[model samples]
Target: MSQHTFLTLDEVASNLKVTRQTVSKYIQAKELNAVKINKSYRITIKDFENFVNSNSTSQEPSISYLRKTKNCTLQYSDKSDDFEVVHGIFHGELRSLSNNGKLTPNKFIFGDNYFVMKKLLETHRGKVDLIYIDPPFGTGQDFNSIDEHPAYSDKLVDGEFLEFIRKRLFLIRELMSDSGSIYLHIDKKIGHYVKIVMDEVFGYQNFINDITRIKCNPKNFARNAYGNYSDMILYYAKHRDNQIWNDIRESMSEEKRKELFPKNHSKLGYYTTNPIHAPGKTLNGDTGLEWKGLKPPKGRHWRYSREVLDELDEQGLIEWSGNGNPRKIVLAKEHKGFKIQDVWEFKDKGLSYVEYPTQKNHDMLERIIRNSSHYNSIVLDCFAGSGSTLRVADKLGRQWIGIDNSTHSLNVIQKSFKEDNINFELLEYVPLD
Candidate 1:
């Protein structure tokens, strides 16, 4: 007998000619055997065969329907050309520009990120904890400062642009720890293609979120299409369920806070009341029992045990209505805030108000850093642009590395860091032919 292999939910669905949800139902009903791994389910070939034999009356062999599943990946001409490009064994030299005498100085490299990242792999492979890059959006246009000074050119479009990012992604993957994550920010025009490339680089199973970032206010465009005010951020983990995720919640706005907690207690502050009974019936539990001469409503059970209800009533946390109904009082001050969603609104400042073109919002970077990384975690940004990620990482107490080839970007980073009293080591990449 051949050794059995494990299959994903998708592969099982394909072989069974059924939906993935049906396979999941089989797992839930214990009609099929499956194991939970990380955040997903995996079924063994033996279990799959057992399921088929038990369900079908036909005399067909189960192995006949089970085909080896093909791993989906994007293919394009010269996509492998990136791996063919070889560099010399020379390690680029690092010159310490300004060291704050800390144990590990943050790095700000002024060089091509491809070569710089290769240099980084020599000492930092599988060490970085988080990476965030806002690379050129493949628009085939040059960005400039408000004073018309050249910033950088995004001349690589279409396949060439995809190859550019794909090559860097391969290197970035090597530099990431098993628990690391990366977030790529790009415009919507070419974001879908980039997502496919990312899915190929990082396993499709590790793909996490495609966040929609509102970059600007609604525009009145002269064209027939609607105004474009958003871009996308593709987030992925080196390994699913192993990456750092702080689950940061968004603070409720003042208006929303007031609306939800309308009643204000003279001593306890703002609060709201909820019914003491819940939707489901408890057949024989204590929650189904009566408390203080009040039975739960029909087809409902008390949200808590009668003992806990009595404790709450004694503590004055329960309010009784005129009709003799008890409700639980929830204080707004005790709320933990709302969960962060996929859609974000962080408008970029005008070019005149920024030192570099297309500079991202600092608060938005702060949110990403706080949610995805921890103190002293190594954060990397290859397409450093205006160094928003580095600044936010430094402020959040994470060590950072920033790499950019543009002279204008390097100057802006140096100036900004100097003004902020940030100490870092600057290096230049010199390729040896």
Candidate 2:
């Protein structure tokens, strides 16, 4: 709560002329003061400023907080370029895939399309980059009663809830990138078991991060476990390597960049670089292939052969540091904003209130999408309650497909977006004749 100004790990590492790992080491050693989310790290400006005001600072980052890279019970088998959706054992089809990639959904439809997720997923197979669901989390009944728009309720029993989630998750997995991810937002009553089941389906190794999201603002209840200040977000990456992520840059104080990279004329600013191994020698580690003229770092093995280093030096991707161990220059740019943290503060947009009773913040989804999905990548929200994901997709300039089955839910979602003036690819929703 005290972090007023935050600096991302990459920024801090860049400023310190050190690796992110080193920066994290410093945080762990208490040589540096910072806040750490599950996998990523952040530094408060005040703490960093105070430390800098005192003296020269370069701290080693702690090894803790690195995402556990355990293997899972996963085997790669090619199905198709698309996702492998498991057809629902008990089935039916509605306007199932209409809102998928064709139209921008506005609200949750009132219908029993849950059984159709598997079949529907195959349509857009291998399409969605990220999936976030804030399905019913309360102990209430799910009904088709008139005027009770958005259709489902939290009143379903845990057994039924598990089934609901189990069925959908099967289809959801088929739709994710082995490098993609999913965020399941749920409450405590079922959060524990839900997590276990998620591990079972997504594989424990794929588990990314679990966040407790506080949904209520004004606390009305008393005597509880830390109050109902949050719900849970269970995350799982389809694959660790190759999962897409980019450096989120932020504006650096001109002073910071200048101090880190002196005389660096590259538009990325004064940055450091690594050296290419000496010519006529092979780099160890990688192929041990020899390069003609570049010398490798002392004691350290070269990663490439002599021929490869010569080729890299020619390509200009390899900028050399004066030292034997070449400090590979990490290209820098005058950043305007740093990448966001795993812990997201809620953002109240027009859709937040109308999205879903449990709709999450747009900024939150943006972070997930930014880290996981690529531009023009299609996102699917089967539980597209208030169209938060759809709206955010439109705003982010990405394609999307939203599915829901409640007429009331659909009306609210569509109306909310229309009122907000959010543009979408409108699809024809034919009615009963």
Candidate 3:
């Protein structure tokens, strides 16, 4: 007998060319044998083989058929099939260019991202923890540095651009771990179509947030529309609800603190108060009885147990009004950070203030990396323009991989990395011509 191995829902889904939810439905319907393990489902190889063999039929729906049956899909010219794209052969190899003389998992690949990422799939398949790509925004314009040096081009637009991104997205999906995530920063003009493309690749259910990033100050351009001071980031998870989420929060602003915590105590600093009594009544508990010669209010119970309330009052953590109403005092110093929302404001600087054109804000990249990846996880940026994502990932103590083909981008990244003393191996994609 052969030793049995178990596969996760994502693994099964990938092999079956379907969504994880589809595989879950099979498990729920008892069509596929699966066992619960650590709050997740696992299918033995034998059982999975048995299910596929037993379910095999002459009229089984094809992957293209399945694609069409999706509740929603982006239909465009030259759209490749998922199977063809995932298994497509790109005739290229990653040739090592330089070794930093130290053992490092970090790499900087100089090549077209599409081919480089395909080569990466050989070793890094389903291993990347986080991906952040600021690809071309399909503006059909060339970008330049402050010195008028040509940086990159974004001439592909319409269906050509969509297909280009869609093809790479399939490769990106293959490179992501089951708990991985991707954040694609793009201009708002083409971001909507890319959203549909993401939906097709990552599945709509896995779509996380369309983060509206305020990238610049409001511009008073003479146009027929509002000032386009913001771009969008399409955030998606490889598997919904299973991606790495540190739930990092933002600290309260000083003005916001002053507004919320209006009262100030010379001894205790800023503070606020909340009603001590809650809505429900505690009929048979000590909370129903009076502690300081006061009966329980009508249909209300003490927020805390009577003993706890007594302790709070003794500790001067309670405020009593002139009419004898008691409230709990909350100090500003003890405040937890506020939850981060979908909208973000991390403005980018001018071309003169940056080494590379369209260099992103460091703080924004930091927030994404800190929230979505661990210290030991591999963070990848295929369209690594200025290598800002790689720098931030390195700063956060994460392993990073960057891929770009532009000479200017490589020059900027090399100089910047050398200044920061970041060591990494460099490789180039070589065609077997």
Candidate 4:
């Protein structure tokens, strides 16, 4: 197997018992990596070896070994129909190291999305609190192929991509618990189409937010407009009334803290209080009662009931301006981080990109995963390109199911997880070996 010497095309043809024309065809096709020296075609011994090794009849082409790694699995506490099972998962005590943390492989799925989906259904369906995915935008990789080869189209046109997403989105909806929400990622190319599809399935009014992510510094484009710089993530729920969303409160800023609580020094944690009344009528347009010597502000009403005010005043939660409106006392720290801004973004904070075109940042993924999901929640990324989504989900103590058709992506994801110390918390490693 030591290929210390190069081989000529004629020699390769002879060795493989192919004709010269067949060998030349491969050379012209760039299928064989050969160098040209003074009109002489020469194949490097390493390139020759790699070519030979990559020619394995497996249905999948081997990828660069040094490029990526992996070792993690999505697990579930319940089971259901429709989800596929991923067999041949390697079982072992192997581990991986990472900068954020270490992990060990607890389970493995050496199969495709449908295969993995079955397993997820068996394990996590109806148990997930949130399901967020950044599916492939239909890049025509073998991963998205239904017939086992790379599709010739970018993604199916005429609602092809729509239907493609619709199928998986429906499954994700089924897998989620009644209180769950789904935040899907897509580019503008089909973001709206995908949204329409999601509305058709998940209901339109259930739509929450359209999250825009800043992926890069804006890659160079030949277009008339500015180079594209963001990706849109659409949020939706199964039922608007059935969704589980916490109305989180953020600590007041230093200025806001002092401005509102100017006379207080309660710095334990920043908090805020509502004034005696809100400058608005009731939701039904009914005004509130007068207090002391003043009627509630015009078109406004008491934010709290007399009984609630009495309780707050008793608990020191009430603030009086002596001559103006009454304010409630709150810890300035009670304000959550920035009121959960609609635009979520991350710019080269500490992590570097994977260098692959269209690769999402792991740092960006961490934010989405943390904000949308919780510990041990079920997360699904059907277009789970690069597997970064799954990697972050695993680290965040979440169980996940990632479905990608690209053997290249699968390889990148696997190797990324394996080589990383991400496998310490894991149970074992079943390298696709």
Q: Which stretches of candidate 1 lie over 4 Å from their true place?
A: 1-72, 81-91, 98-104
Model 2: CA > 4 A from native: 1-85, 88-91, 94-110, 141-151, 214-221, 247-341, 347-356, 420-433
Q: Poorest 10 consecutive residues of model 3 by lDDT?
A: 61-70
Report lDDT (CA) for all predictions: 0.84, 0.58, 0.87, 0.58
Error of 3 at 336 (Å): 1.3
Per-residue C-alpha lDDT of model 3 across residues 227-346, encoded as one tens digit per residue: 999999999999888899999989989999989999998888999999888788898998888878777689988888889998999999999999988889999999988999999999
Comparing 2 with 3 on lDDT, the higher-scoring candidate is: 3
Instruction: Identify the leading candidate in terms of lDDT.
Output: 3
Q: Candidate order by TM-score, highest to lowest? A: 3, 1, 2, 4
What are the root-mean-square deviations of the candidates from the true structure over C-alphas? 9.1, 19.2, 8.1, 21.9
Superposition TM-score, candidate 1 onto the true structure:
0.82
Please give, for residues 284-359, the per-residue lDDT of candidate 2 as tens digits.
3453433444344445456555556656667664665555333345454533455544554463443333434545
Which ten contiguous residues of candidate 4 have the minimum total lDDT?
66-75
Clashing pairs in 3: none
Error of 4 at 255 (Å): 7.5
Residue 13 CA error for candidate 1 (Å)?
Answer: 22
Estimate the overall C-alpha local distance difference test score of candidate 3.
0.87
Error of 1 at 356 (Å): 0.3
